[model samples]
Target: MKVGLFIPCFVNELYPHVAMATLELLEGYGVDVAYPMEQSCCGQPLANNGDSSGACDAALRFTGVFKDFDYVVAPSGSCVSHVTHHYPWYIADNADFQRLQPRVFEIVEFLQDVLKVDKLPKPVHFPHKVSIHQSCHGLRELHHASPSELMIPYQSRLERILQLVDGIEIGQPERRDECCGFGGTFSVDEADVSVAMGRDRVAQHEATGAEYIVGADPSCLMHMGGIIRHNGRAIRPLHVVEILTGRGGAA
Candidate 1:
């Protein structure tokens, strides 16, 4: 399948190698992947911050850059969730974007739903106990797994894929679907609460004896990573794709 990759702002600027692992994994699958430099933010930050006008502009630009691809995929669940759920709010009745919306996917869902991938890379091996931190957007918005509020049963697409990785043992914290408190603008606007939430979430994961914490979206991991660093903890944070590529958290 032809793919257009959308790198979230933070991943593009700060965690570039993590971004490369994501791109490389898709390419490794023999899928034709394109990274459009013309791409910008998914308008999530703008929209989340109550700037619908700016978000609309970003939305249009995103559409202009990715509309032609068979699938528009992003390493970020939060960003893709915004596009899938909120983009139409600004561009009311825009047929072009509406048609493209369903084709867009967050990377994990794209892998589970599109590629039907049944295993990790042939040579991938991550021999460590890691806990999964579910990104709120990916979990609640995209339905990545069964939310704690639901009585329904479900499976995590990301975890299922990770289960196929050799020598990789994936675990979960006490609260499976709790947010990492990095709700985009929510972190900045509610600093104390965000950190408290992060601390609590990290503590739960740490209790699992996990040497590393991994998740489909790095934004959530990034928040918890900060808490880990500040507290001088040894737990490492990583994108699932990084482990899937056998790259680990290497520089």
Candidate 2:
């Protein structure tokens, strides 16, 4: 299928490898993925900051870039959630664009739901216990948890994908669904609360004695990661897509 690859601004800049892995994973699954170099922000930052007008320009740019594709997929659930969930609210007056929002899908959701990729990348050995921090957007907004509730007693596509990686023990965190306090602009505006929440999240992960905390959202990971690093902690945060794509470590 022809797919438009939407790389969020931070993913393009700081986590380029995650985007790279996304491409590789899609291509490996026989998807005809194309990147529109002209694609820019999904305007989530501006929208979250209560500036819908600023978001409109970016949304228009985004819609123009990926409108032709059958599906728009991104590695970020938060970004996809913004476009699919929030963009409609921003452009409620524009009936044309509101209908287009449903075409967007977060990468894992696309792979699991649409493509139904049962076989994944060859398992890589990490040999360490790791905890998972489910990003709020991915879990709650995107309904990643819904499938688990329906299909089985307990199941996470993220955890199941991680299990494909050899020697990686998935540890359960104290409050698995709690936010890491990195609500994009929330981190900068409420520095103390942000750090405190991150510290608490890290402490819970550390309590599990896991070497790494893994999740799909990089923004949350980066926030908690900074706290983990600042306090001289050994725990590290990793993106679930990175781990699934077998690009988890420094190369």
Candidate 3:
């Protein structure tokens, strides 16, 4: 299958290595992939900020860029959630979005659901104890993990995927489903609250004796990581695909 890569703007510009790792992971699975340079924001920020017109412009551009691919896969559940769930709010009645939205999938979901992945990188040595930080979008919107509220029992797709790797131990934070407080613009408008929430999450993960915090969303990691660094803590925030791709320094 020819997959079109959709790296969120922040991932593209700030966390380029994560984007590269995602691509590398997919290629390692022997899937055909394409990264179109024209792709940009899925207008998530604009839509989150209630700027419909601006969001519409961005969504239209995104739809145009990945419209032709068999699948539009992104490393971020947050971005994919925005594009898949919110584009209709901005575009209202556009055909471009209708054509592209159904084919969009977050990388992990694509690998597990579409590709039926059963293994990960071999000869990888990751000895650190790591905790999973389920991004809100990934958890609730995508149901990447079974939420505490759900009566139906379902395993976390992420944790299972992580287990595919060798020499890795996974831990769950004290409160598994809580937000990291980086609700996109939530950090900017409510800086203190965001920081406190991030600090709380970092502390919870630290209590698990985890040296690294891994999640599907870099945005959450970037937020929690800032507070982690400011407090002189050694906790590392990483994207899961980084681990699977055997990105250098991961071991």
Better of 2 and 3 by lDDT: 3
Residue 112, model 2: lDDT of: 83
Instruction: Give the per-residue lDDT digits (tens) of candidate 1, residues 159-228.
Output: 8878878787888899887888888778889989999999999999998898888888878988998999
Please provide TM-scores, in order, for all candidate models, with all chains considered together.
0.96, 0.91, 0.96
How many angstroms is residue 212 displaced in model 1 relative to the true structure, after the best TM-score fit?
A: 1.0
**lDDT (tens digit, per residue) of candidate 2 on 38-133:** 988899999988897899878887877888888989988899998888877767566556556777999988988898777775556777788988
Best by lDDT: 3
User: Per the 3 Å backbone cut-off, how many clashing residue pairs does candidate 2 have?
Assistant: 0
Query: Can you write out model 3's per-residue Cα lDDT over 195-251, one digit (the tens) per residue?
Result: 999999999999999889999999999999899889999888988988888773453
lDDT of 2 at 138: 87
What is the Å distance of residue 130 in model 3 from its true position?
Answer: 0.7
Rank by lDDT, descending? 3, 1, 2
**Model 2: which ten-residue window has the lowest total lDDT?**
146-155
